[model samples]
Target: MFLLSLPFSLASAAELKFTNADESRAEFERSVKPFLTKHCVGCHGAKEPEGELDLTTLDPDMKSSTSGARWATLVEKLTKGEMPPEEKPRPDAAGLAATIDWAHAESKRANRNFTRRAAYENGNITPHSVLFDPKNIPPFDGESRVRRVSPEIYETFLKDAAKRPGTNQPFSPLGGTTFKDMGDPTIDEPVTATLFRNALIIVEGQTVHTVENGKIVKWNGARELQPLFDPQVAPTDAQLEAAITFQFKQILKRPPTDRELEKFVALLKRNMAEAGQVVGSRYALATVLMLTEAVFRMEVGSGQPDEKGRVRLAPREIAFAIGYALTDKGPDSQLLAAAATGGLGTDEGVTQQVRRLLDDAKTDKPRILRFFREYFGYDKASYVFKEANSGGGTIDFPGHDPGSLIADTDRLIEYILEQDRDVLRELLTTNKTFVAYRTAADWQKKLVEARKKFDAEKKANPEKYKNREFNPPVKMVCEAYGLSDFPEQQPVELPKDQRAGILTQPSWLVANSTTFDNHAIHRGKWIRERLLGNVVPDVPITVDAQLPNTPEKTLRERMAVTEQAYCWKCHQLMNDLAYPFEQFDHFGRYRAMDSVVDIEATAKLEGPRRNQTKRVMQDVPLNRSGLVAHVGDASLEGPVDGAVELMHKLAASERVEQVFVRHAFRYWLGRNESPGDAASLQAAHKAYQESGGSMKELLSALLTSESFLYRVPASPEPNAVPKAASKKANS
Candidate 1:
């Protein structure tokens, strides 16, 4: 065990100058022991030590035992006024301060000795501190490095390379907590092997031959690569160079340098000489350029450094950065032209490009939508499974599909983004939403009439309508779902009071809930972490967090078990925040009471099915009273009656808007926020406030900020040579 001796040694040296150990021991016995006996010994003494602390057994000599760390904890608790349980006698202010000071002094001495001893044993010492200051953060040096392309971006790049609308081939999906792909790429064995396999498949074509039951079952036509490889006639040297340049531009978003071009040209020539034309060219394209770092990694910045030890991003890099920030695709022709002419080098030029991109209807604004999906975590709705043969079918909707719910949420988000109003506030409080069915119109009325007539005729004479089919009015749903004609349906507007913003949306409600019942804890935890930026500590390992399956009690009543001191310590921070969402059922349908039901023994046998079981459901009055705190805004932190009221308060919060700005910073920069990026974050926030919370304005400000425009060199060795200088020296 690590031991501390510095404090006692220092005390001894000081005592030799003025006093003696006998006087110090007498003072400790008179003051410290009496204080502990009066205020701490009851719960933390010999008979039954609380928190495993036995203050009575501790040695009076601070450095003789391994008790300095325990002393530090004691000091922290006393200083924070968390010791001396509420019913117990409290320490006087002077006494508390003096004790805390002594403990601190002892802790420092012990820490100093511990550091020296650790360095001697481990060859290094690490600093430990409880305080953090933003001013201590280092500035961005504007260095740039290569990062791998994300899965989505790689697909887009492949489409551009193949000169097709899309290949429709699947790539491996990235995994993370957020729906957004922020995973760092690794050149692991599995990754490289997968890349090689994909490269070969793309170059050759997709083909399928299936045999089943000892028979030749099916064969599909192999995918043709003629469109991608066709040059119309035998290729000339200039034609090959032109093709190489085009491919380079398409994949890398820039032309190859002369050196790179020469190397590739030599490789192409050698391949052509050995294998003739088509086969060699295909092999070269697949194995050489397609597999290079230039195709897979986004390498930004020219090595030229300014006086401030920062480097400006290459003009092309600026264009690609701005383009990728707004959309999944690389820079368009106009952006590339601007970069080529050095027009993208200034703030004004970048602002112009940003505005143009945001205004472009063709630009994939879905990328922005995707950020919100990941930020809110509503996308998890797609994977939620409801049991078909379970008790309490009270919350069931006949046609409620998780995919449709997610799509509806996306539509609502897209609508709000298109309007470009107070984006954060609107998302929190807007009542309007799109449903799976469109609003009823003249065609809808006619379709309804036709459906009614058909139903009547079918009821009267089933045989007459057995072979007949009915068409509905909507067009897009039919097309979207791959139906030959519209289905029978009419859309209904949601009740305004029953719903509000994203919080009440079925996507969020269902995603955060269990199969048969609501998960108030999950809902509250999401709001606390994602919106308010407050972290909830993990439950203790000793605690079993499950609720008892009591048929008589409602979920709220059962959850009241957490009100006990041991459980309430952590649950208090979450349960109150989640209580308000009790207004909505597991399926997000508004309800006045909690559905209570007895689970049949056979319910467990039912697996991964939906809308099959029926059970007697009793209504229990739902207690929707909830408390909201730690939002970092006074106006928004208070008791709320339900989800609607909570949303109203959140909509008015400045902190909510700031949280959104931070999320945007993470989304565009592909990293978390740092103190060095504060200026950019502030500018984005300012733009949102000044422009009435226009998302486009925030994007423009962020894209033009110093953090986005420049980078520091990856290596800072004084004698390190620049890439251009190194190339010249090699030549």
Candidate 2:
């Protein structure tokens, strides 16, 4: 889809200072001004700018002005390649690309990225009423979208798409943690490099190279390639068909259409002619590995349109959606069977298949647990670096490392989901916790099994395994917590008074904390947005966000700077919401008092000259109070004593439950919630409430809703980027 229209105000643009010294402004005037004046300013000029946007007077300094957001939106509009009204002269391709790059760079300076902006708005910034109202749904047409698979999902995709299972080097496009949870599937050349490299890697791994004489043909090569690489003989039409047919079964799960087969045959023949038989087979395989459908989850419906101008997704499409939503792998045999029999074309059929996947205890549907991991943000625990002596001086809390805490949280989520009752509420208020815990029996059994394998291998060749120790890997617990040496009790019942829900868990606290202190703002921000369905605007461009680093003052007292008139407008939404978390230290240990360093209290002259000074530690009573303001629901608003109490109050709020539903819709749908999605959102929320908060009931209702099942395509236009093929595996 294209933005088509963007509304910006130039009211403040004229007030900014601009001169020859301002290189950015100078470039804008010289290079960008004419492009805008010709293609944009005619309709968006001072006389009567369309959508209240005056491009002629638009500010160039996007880094420190309100124009940043508008500029970012403009970049999105241009990059979408659908601007210029679709009737006016198209932009100069070379100039257009330069302008987009410049605008995107400026947008980054102000920390506004529009690629993921739509999903963010739908999940967080949209008005709660607009997304949840029963009477506010759009017509029964689906917005076709493509969601990018994550690196993990891509690994699974490779295994399912081709016979290849693993790669030598891990494939990461951005090379860091820059990706948002569910980002837009963008069309960019940068991805071409990542995709092609990985595709080549897949093809190379599958090819078994045996450089013998051409006369020697052995079973050493893979059976799939034997026919294609027959000694000294070119592949025949029948051989090509057989080769494609085998790949279809191994990878695509269904026979390729005649057109698809023809294309593959042509590609194979071309590659064999250009390169030798063995080399050409690898090239042909690489082409198959690069198919966009194998890399991205495509949701464009294939069936014909109905009387209501809606298109129902084909059985295969529905199965793929259900499978991708629930698991990283492709549609299982059962799902494929359902699609083959046309069982996925109806609402009941989709619901039944989804429930079947949910019911299978043996199937590790990590996506279900994956949602809670992202939803709670406990998955980030391992990444939040903390010095050994950051807050609490001692490292007594060594057992509950970030990874273990996240695993414990995952197990906790799975436990709650296993019960499938009051899931959201249970996640917020449960006192059950796992501390350096896993099933000891299971651990011992694994240890014995691994030891046996190692001993057998080492015995087979003692000199070959000279110095290697029998150190087996563990999961969901600390590697050094000594599961083999000292087993921990499972699912220990933490004190209800100290720990209630996941909010009070050590993992959550540590993930949201700073390296040197507790991050009340981050903690508060999570609750305000994730729980209350409210948004806190980004910190202003003009504000210097650093707090006073006075060790004598409490964290709260030092944070008093945010209460200043200039800052409180946004901080008021987060600071108090986070204040309740102060009862827990930066290490997440519950405390009635804060551990602080008071230089005067610990002052001592200890040198021989009696001039050297030392400062010892002291404690101050903690202020663990928080306010629940502007929650929309009057009953849910008030002052709370601690994080647990605040969480309990939030858990009881209907708005909280509805917000949870809205987020789930965004996560599973791989897009933002629209006015059209209100019906689905409302139904899912209602299902959760009516079925005693069963996630099964909620997902069933959501998966079967019109938003997931029907597609209402927009009217065809020139230069519209097809959503399905463009999407990659980013999520």
Candidate 3:
């Protein structure tokens, strides 16, 4: 659509298409020489050849030389959109195109004789080739990087250690804690210590129907698997020695050092001789402590058992890893002790262990329940009202007269396993729990009374409860169920939005709050950091500043506008996210309408704003906007078809999958998966999808993947700077 123009003097151009030298010279002068003279000669030609590049004095004969390559390099600069100097006299589009074509033609002719280079000559893989070229990779090959004798290896090691006829024994929980802290091992601590972390496992079962014809035929077996970790369970005097030796071998992926082996023997002998019992619980506890170390941490191995890089963990260790990762409490001592005695080796014991792990009144009921909540981003299950089933379980609410008690653990598990509904709906909407009313009525009554009393105390003194609400109450249930409590409160709800989800829960409001301030900066930051995983560093402490207290004003206005500047520096991000939860009252109960005068609904969370506003003035609480309405499975009526469909949609999304994978990676790998790990992660992610997102399958894939078992750190690359700019400046 556009006409062309060119000037003579093609000889000066660096690159040009030509049938011969004469043709190239003509093309260069006619199409490229004039343009360069007008736009580039002033800086690089006669007066000053910046970076030693002079377009006006360009030599047509030096076609194969590096100096002749400068013009071709300039064309690349223009292609990348980083040139034109912004203030310089730039060539028009057509002129630039002509230059580009000429440069490419000359480059091709000049590079014609260059031969392709072969791979490494000595067979020693170069870093560049090994990383950049997949085919050149030889160092890894699974056997080299993938260490054998994971927890699976531990089983053999334990057997060996136990048979070694040593004197060291396992630690006991009854006598006292025997496990030393992983971060600090100066003092022996209980396995139930506060440093425990829980692992999350989501299960989805697909019903496979085998139909030969139209009529129903038979049901295929149900494939069930879970993300499991093996814990070191060695209790006997000899077992302790074997466990340490085995741990060293597994961690190092080779034989243990003689010195290390001797140390293990010495430690075991001392423990057994001092404790006066080789088969005591102490020996088992000590072994568990060793397994908790970083060396024992394994990635979700390859999705399949036969994967080349798969990291294998022993069965008991798998159980321990699952328990430790999923809950604040470490491995269940009872389960470990049972395992140490080899009771879990039989079919019945294995089944019992699975059931026991899931049925342990201490961990399964409360700790596992909390683990689910932690994964779901909620502190507790939502309330729900459902008629008790035919399951025989007495229900009870202690502290409250005539409270029903739930006797069976199965009934309790069923009541909480409704994965379709958000926990908020289950906790606030449900009033019924499968309880053996007659069996646990008295205990149930006491608990109900305590809750009622707690609720009454909160209502009587709004100020007292205001800062006390948020996730604390749900956490209390966890503690009562024997799980270690995090004891930190987080604002989970907005004041305007009732339903006591976060704002009113006892754990969230009081743990980090002041008696007077409902939403203190400290509490707000804690909620953002802990609940949302936002890493908001702490602000420097200063003298307490008096904040305005008005019924009409939101927390932000009262703090930022009235408070000093030192506060806003850090409060900016906190206010953006926290203010949204103000819709919830202190008791976590949502109110459709509040009778209080000068009703206020202004709060914001901590994050950068699009408008770059200094204050959170325009944002409205979630309740007022109807964005956060009551949601429940029953409310949708009938079966949760829509919710299931939505979940499928989320699971299918790359973003959602990434979130799950990231969370799972952090759990299994003990650190954030680096971008360099993307290859292995990509492979594992593919396996996960292929395995239908089965929690166990995904974990298997990750554990077996190269990134999980290998410990090689990624190398950094040097920053690249275009050579054209350097040459131009020098001229």
Candidate 4:
């Protein structure tokens, strides 16, 4: 988004003149090859090549060599400033731009229509420092693409149309680090076949069932096919049109276009000619379910491109995007009316609608909740497998109940979101967490008390008790190490020492845990990438990633393998940040003894635990001290006692808040920020800070930013500018 001043590289790049092959190869030697030797050969060459890419021998001639394909794969890596990764040396801006500009020119001349990898394809490709750099806010990276309606949304479409639920969910949502809403599934042969089969099942499942003579019958609602059920009467154009219109509204949420109307009608007649009325009508409805419009909600802008090649999304597209961004359903009637009446055209207009939907309590804004869940990654707790039935293995005490602390974490997040004040900080440092009512251990005690009171009341007043069924006021809360079921709208407060924010929550701890121990490396990596907004380079292929899982050694001792100079380069970013969490075990039980696994709650309840606590839970010294570093702020970087202290420090940092805002951009905008998107990110950060950390204001500002409202379709000379550095002399 930096305003593209006329390129200084034009005089330099014009020297290459890829008009033919010979001149280009000569220029590659003069400029490209020599420049890379001086700037890039350090990591990408012979000594220790990363990503299996040996750039020293790569051919620069895109016109003829086999290396053209390899260059295709690497274009984004080079242009996005991901080359010479943060830890390594990099070219000055002019040197970097010259190399990238050379790549673009060659690719254009080669006429290679390689698939463009947008920001959503890989969020970590852009530098975090570059993204949040306050002084260099660019115009904006307006996204331009259409995402297929996710499998979940397609299932809802089925439910709305046929009055039946979907079963064959072909689109599996991605998990771990990636945003739920951002996906681009290729629709090739097999995918097309799956959609066809899925659609047929939905249409056929709606038929009414009945026996000719005897017992009761099942009713199937083939309501769309009802008129065609009577084959004795020949079908008319009117009936076909009515069916198509109905299916259009039920599935696509809009009336069919004249072209679409004719296309479907012709389809019905052709099928009817071959296979009778019932099959034809049924196939026709199923076909409607598979329309491209039905499958993918287009976010591609509506109007012609502006002078800068940006396009604002049309009102209807805006409505659809906003609806799915905040909720599971399509735009409501009010939202649709606004789109129809041009209420989504301007910034104020779009802001008005977004604010209305966000404010409406009845609207199930699950996307808001989903953002936090995915952001913190606590939802992965269930996926971390541990055996409960095998008694020899550690009993998942606090984790015994299915999703026990997961629900607790959810409630805590909801509580903070409801208050909506400094939400990110509250989620990180809040001491008040939801545990089972009163005490999880006292459920039976409370039940006894409730029964005693109930019996006394019944004894005193027999007439009143005659018709009443006894239900205990004190009941078990089936999460937070819960054993029984209790119905309560809100949970009781847990003490400060017992919990602190999402990071310290038992579910998150359990989720991040490896099979045998707490995944401190992964945990620190998560904080490094997610909270600190930095990328940890992929583990080089040569490094053996597995720790020597020695139960006899402490987790740190086992991790001794990572301290080698090569390994430590990346490990330094994670280990110090992660060790603080060692005070809590994989199950998130406080580890008083270093060597002994903490006793689970269920182990105490079911067995002779007093003896087992002494036998199984033996002793060793504990180390909870850890350091926070590389986060840019010296004030925020230091030694800390444990996760609580760590989380508090992170929660208070402006850098961390900006990281949170960047993630919210990913969730709301559905892509990582491009260089142009710095403007949007900065504006949103300013709004959050100025609004006293209101998520609503932050979201409003982001949703209305230039990046949200408009899109750049392709790279242009006018925009897509790189930060410039002076041309460097080659070695």
Give lDDT tens digits, candidate 2, residues 1-731.
Answer: 34222122122222223332265566566767888877888877898665445776667765444455456546645654445766788887656755654554444445554454444443454457756756645445355666556566776766643435444223344321112336456545666666776676666655555546875444554466567876667678988887877766655678878998999999898888899787787778767656766666677777677887878777888888888788888689999999999788678888889899988878767787777877888778788887654323354344346766777778888788888999999999998876545444555576689889999999999999999887653432332222333334556666677787888888898899877688888888788878887756566656898889887888899999999876786688899999988988776777888867777644553554233223345788889898999666788889999888988898898999998897788777766565556777888898899999999898888788888888776555454333432232012
Q: What alpha-carbon RMSD in Å does predicted model 2 have with respect to the real structure?
A: 10.1
Error of 1 at 688 (Å): 0.2
lDDT of 4 by residue, 1-731 (tens): 22223334334533434676666666567667776887777766976564435688777766434355446546555654445566677566666656755665675566532334334544554555556767755555465677787766766655654444444656755443258667564576777888888777777665444434433244456465555545446668888887788778876778888998999989988898888766777787789778877778787786788886789988888888888888767788887888889898888999999899888999888778888888888988889976553233444452343265677788888888788899889898886666543344465676788788989999999999988866643332343422235534454444565556888777888889965578888898889878887656555434568888455567877777888876786788899898888878777766556764345533454455453433234456878788988665777899998777888888889889988888999888776766678878888999999888888989889878888788866545543334442221110
Give the better candidate number (1 or 2) by TM-score. 2
Question: Candidates ranked by TM-score, best first?
Answer: 2, 4, 1, 3
Ranking by lDDT: 4, 2, 1, 3
Per-model C-alpha RMSD = 14.4, 10.1, 23.5, 10.9
Name model 1 segments beyond 4 Å from true. Answer: 1-138, 141-145, 160-174, 177-179, 200-240, 273-277, 288-299, 303-308, 392-395, 437-496, 537-545, 561-570, 598-614, 631-633, 716-731
Give the per-residue lDDT digits (tens) of candidate 3, residues 419-509: 4233323332232333232344344455567688878888899886887843333333332222233223221112221222223333333
TM-score of 2: 0.76
Q: Residue 571's C-alpha lDDT in candidate 4?
A: 86
**Local lDDT at 647 for model 1:** 84
Candidate closer to the true structure by TM-score (higher is better), 2 or 4: 2
| C-alpha lDDT of all candidate models, in order | 0.63, 0.69, 0.38, 0.70
List, in order, the clash count of every candidate structure. 7, 7, 145, 6
Task: Itemize residue pairs with steric clashes in candidate 2.
Answer: 138-676, 142-712, 148-728, 148-729, 148-730, 149-729, 149-730
